[model samples]
Target chain A: MATATIAGADVTVDEEGFMTEFSEWSEDIGSALAGQIGIDLSDAHWKVLNFVREDFQAQGETPTLRRVSKVGGVPTKELFQLFPKKPAKKMSYIAGVPKPHGCV
Target chain B: MKRLLILGAGTAGTMVANKLRPRLDERDWNITIVDQDETHYYQPGFLFLPFGGYSRADLEKPKRAFMPKGVNLIMGEIDLIEPEDNQVKLVDGTTLPYDYLVIATGTSPRPDETPGLDSDEWYKSVFDFYTIDGAEALAKKLETWEGGRLAINVIEMPIKCPVAPLEFIFLAEAYFAERGMSDQVELVYVTPLPGAFTKPVAARYLGEMLQERKIGLEADYMLEQVDTENSKLISYDEREVEYDLLVTIPVNMGADFVDRSGLGDELNHVPVDKHNFLSDAHDNIFAIGDAAALPTSKAGSVAHFAVDVFTENFLDYIEGLPMRGEFDGHANCFIESGRGKGMLIDFNYDTEPLPGKYPLPGVGPFSLLMETEANHWGKVMFKWMYWNILLPGRELPLPALMSMAGKIPEKVG
Candidate 1:
């Protein structure tokens, strides 16, 4: 049981530092979290974050990376450049969506 | 009565027991299989656990279920093998004498060997998918993890399932996109080899796949330590790669008893003739599967094919006749790419994996070295074949030796 103060709001997280409640996420909260990880969210980051959040809201499941590359209009190579490390988990964190089940 | 005692009742031992039970006369010969544990695991299932596709219940079964009824099953840890005395001593001070011995004990991931790999960060920020517990723990970690540099490093070479790391990263790419986080994570592959794989052709082909997926490959990396405080992997050459989450395949080695018995090579793998698996030091002892030091990839397919050849040669050797069978070190593996597609690779000791049809030369339902949905299904179906047909020692239509019938070798450049 861990909690992080983000954008003046206390958000719950698991031991691995993943947000426990999607409802507690906000743009300001994501920005605050991103700042801790040494990232300043640009338009590209928001584009993926918003798309993931909307998809999770509608389908109750996150879209696959292939889906993001093909349907979300982001090229595969560009996705790596944007995320720079682990894009799926980071994007879900900022978008206020749950982590994809199979991504490591 | 002659007693044939086999050590480590895993894949190779179990198949040998089942294959020889009826072949040997019950009156003159006694068969016994020894293992430290009663549980048998479908090891390939470990790959699917992190993906929410498998559970402990799906992969575990009783060891006795696969062992033939006539073969005696002994549950005890092996302490040492006294090849000079033709006996094996158990941890509990029991000695089993054997006229012929087969060692099927397999290799295991040894995170402890790497400095700082098993530190406080293990199972927290750093994890391995080779073990069931490690895979299960990672499943939970991935549940809530916000992405960072996900570095998949192979600390050394000669690890089990050489293609598995590639499959994992490929599957990860698909898994991340499915969650619409393709832009939030970076994928990096660090290896000790010079390329994406061991063989030249396969390495070049797989290296391109890595490029297509945008996964950075840091090849020829010899891990020196894991900097837990800073979250980085340091190589012997003083190079460093930082990561938020590190999934690694640690150094793999054979059973410790092999070392204790003074029957092992540098990695504790028993020194055996690559063609027959007969121990170079002892004519009556054979080491098969991951336990043997063969110049081929350590995989289930290799064990199956080796077992096929060893069973025939063993019969001849025990009867004081010339052994007729020779193993060519054939191995086949399915590479799982994301998006419901996969690729297959088949080769032997002399040949590198080449692109062509497998089994059928001109008209294969499955393509080799190329991605297809059919290849994915083949991988899915292999689990069934492993348990029922392969373990039970039932005959498979595939040849034990590598076939060049449909293989296409690259023309001289």
Candidate 2:
């Protein structure tokens, strides 16, 4: 287990820096995680993250990339632009959800 | 009684084994195929892994499952080949002697060959889609990716699936468009070739596709090193292309054991007679697929076609008869252009891909060098054909050689 300090609070992260618990996830933590990966979150980024978080709470699993675009009302290209390098993992990381399976 | 030992039970090796099993008599002949692992990957499926359509199970199966019942399958690391002694030494201290040896150990992506390519940011920032792991990793990356400049680069040429990088860019364009963030990602195709593709006619056609898609073309760019610290590709000619995310197809080289055996070229490819695939250095050895230094694309279709010719020639060689079959270097590929549209290209060593119909003269279910939905379906259906018919050594409706029947002759300029 690895721990990252975001806004002076310790959050548990997996080996790949993915969040270990949803309870530790906050908008501020998401912002800090984004800063570490060299990105600044926008409203659009928040919208996707919120959708993923809500979807996870309701469904008990990370939302598929396709569902985020098709049902979550975000387009695929914008989702990519928001997450940059790796949208699915990065989004799951910031959203404080378990890393998506079958993603690697 | 004699033995035929094959190295690397991959695409070419598996096909050869299946095709030869029924032809060779068990009482007088024994066939053995060796590979480093039990898993046989449908490599073409790797290209689709980054996208949603294909799954991991769809691309992989047990190698022995596809191998014929009579052929012996040995899974171990290959140490060296002592062709003069008619034997191969395995890392586990197993020595297998063969009367005829076939090397089908294919090419692999060598990211380490490029400086800083395998650095700290490998799966984090820089990525490749050539391998299953790489594709899966990229799939995770693409999930919430806010795009910037997406640089799709090829380190060098003679790569397996030469058109794959182009296909990636096309699919990326469509993916971005479908996601409604089309304006966010700027697609750039960086290649060592001057145009979009290797063939002139195909290059012209594919080049237009890039242009129409608004993807930037950075042609004739020879990679020198990956500036991982800065997230940019610095070419040998001092050209630099910055990117937010780098998707590269690294330098592909034949297996290292080929180099150790002293029977390979500078790139570790075994030099073979282009027609019959007989090793230039040894009469009893033949190298097929990406291992052979054939003057054609390093593609599955080429391996399939070559196997068709080699099957006949190989039977004749062991019987002390002159080989009559000459491989014409026939190859065909379906290029996915996204939006449920794709293109087909069929050519050989002597011919370039021209605009025409395939398998028939006037009417074709598939068109060549032109994008069509039918071509995309053909591209999708090929996975079924590859596993069920092609690997089992079943006969296909297509010919092994390129035909001039439906092709339009090049007009004099």
Candidate 3:
């Protein structure tokens, strides 16, 4: 099992590689990830996060990478550097969605 | 032997003074209004100023000209409000005692609250349509602008006429289109709200309208500061939104005298009873318009309706009767949607804006939440009504209270 501590909240990765609790994920994680990727979690980032969450809630599914890239103005390569995996999974993480299987 | 002192000879105070002047016995009660400026601005006309639809002459009138004949209008800076003595001191060290005090100092645009917003780029790159000066400057800037990315940003919530920013964008789009430069401009609406508006149905409808007009919606954008040198609006988290032209609705604060008087909240807005418009800090003190920390939208229509209710209650207080809670937070706004079309919204504390005919119900000349040319015309005509009818304290044909009679209420599933 892999465990990640974000903003003093322990996020545990189960044997199947999914986060146990999504609500535990904090904005600090978004900030930390942004720092790691050499990006700032700015008004623009929150705007994108809110938009993605809204789109997901409306459509019952995550938006494609192209749509997020277009709306967020963040390049796909930059997004990958921030997420390091599936964009949907990263969006889920950023948007505080419960981790799906095979995502650490 | 009660003396009534009204502060600020603006829309709200003027209305209060005029409405009560004839009602109160001149020999028994004395009324005085104090303000620094002599000019009364038709604030709604500020929106049209940026587009050359209005001028300084069209927007301003002598403060005393519109006031009631009997009400004493004193032009001077307010030094402080002495709640204990029930008197307002002027900057000249003169004190006027009052049995009842009405605070209508209104709100001010504190552009300095946002870092670098008031820098050299202000009215050059960053502009606000909320002020007459800002509007005039923006007009000149827009005239020569070749156009690129234009962003309308709201720093925070509880701004005057919450929909004015959206209206500005819509009007700008229409303005550019009229000049055949619409294609050269990329319009973006940036706000701290979760969507285009606060109300759910209005937000959804307004969001769709933005999409239709090809306007970008940057929601939940909490502005941390303005990077004027870099031409970027930076959020608290450091996200940067680049813009060629920034139309900002700055942080609005109540009268500074409120802070000096120790009678205001953090934002300097007076704490008042939501329904009755009576200041909780002092029994004799009342607040209306942008000065009061009311839950209603800080718009002219809200002030008009509130003063209407306040007029009734103030009369009762004079007669030594109990106050009636008649104000329902009734707000009516005409939202311009561009291309000679607009939408009218009427709602109150309990009711959300519903779609249907307005005023006349089934046979209304105006439609609510639905865009129509007639609504746009109504909005345009209001400038005249504001000066001729509303400001003079004349009785309007329509009721001050919000009516759901003509609206088709949305059924909640």
Each prediction's TM-score versus the true structure: 0.80, 0.80, 0.80
The DockQ values of the predictions, listed in order, are 0.01, 0.01, 0.03
Candidate 2 off by > 4 Å: A1-104
**Candidate number of the best TM-score:** 3
Winner by DockQ? 3
Candidates' chain B TM-scores in the order shown: 0.99, 0.99, 0.98
**What DockQ does model 3 achieve?**
0.03
lDDT of 2 at B264: 78
Greater-lDDT candidate between 1 and 2? 2
Clashing residue pairs in all predictions, respectively, total: 17, 21, 1
Cα lDDT of model 2 by residue, B326-358, tens digit:
898899999999999999999988888899988
Residues forming the 10-long window of minimal summed lDDT in candidate 1 chain B:
B264-273
How many angstroms is residue B348 displaced in model 3 relative to the true structure, after the best TM-score fit? 1.2
Q: Which digits, one per residue and each the tens of the lDDT, describe model 1 over residues B1-413? A: 99999999999999999999989999999999999989998998888888777888999889999988789999999999999999999999999999999999999999998889979999999999999899999989887888888999998767898899999999888888898878988999998777898887989999999999999999867677899899999976668999999999998889999999999865787878889999989989999998997778889999999999988898889889988899998999999988999999999888989999887896777788999999999999998999899999999998999998888999955
Candidate 1: stretches off by over 4 Å: A1-104
Q: In model 2, what is the error at residue B115, expressed in angstroms?
A: 0.3
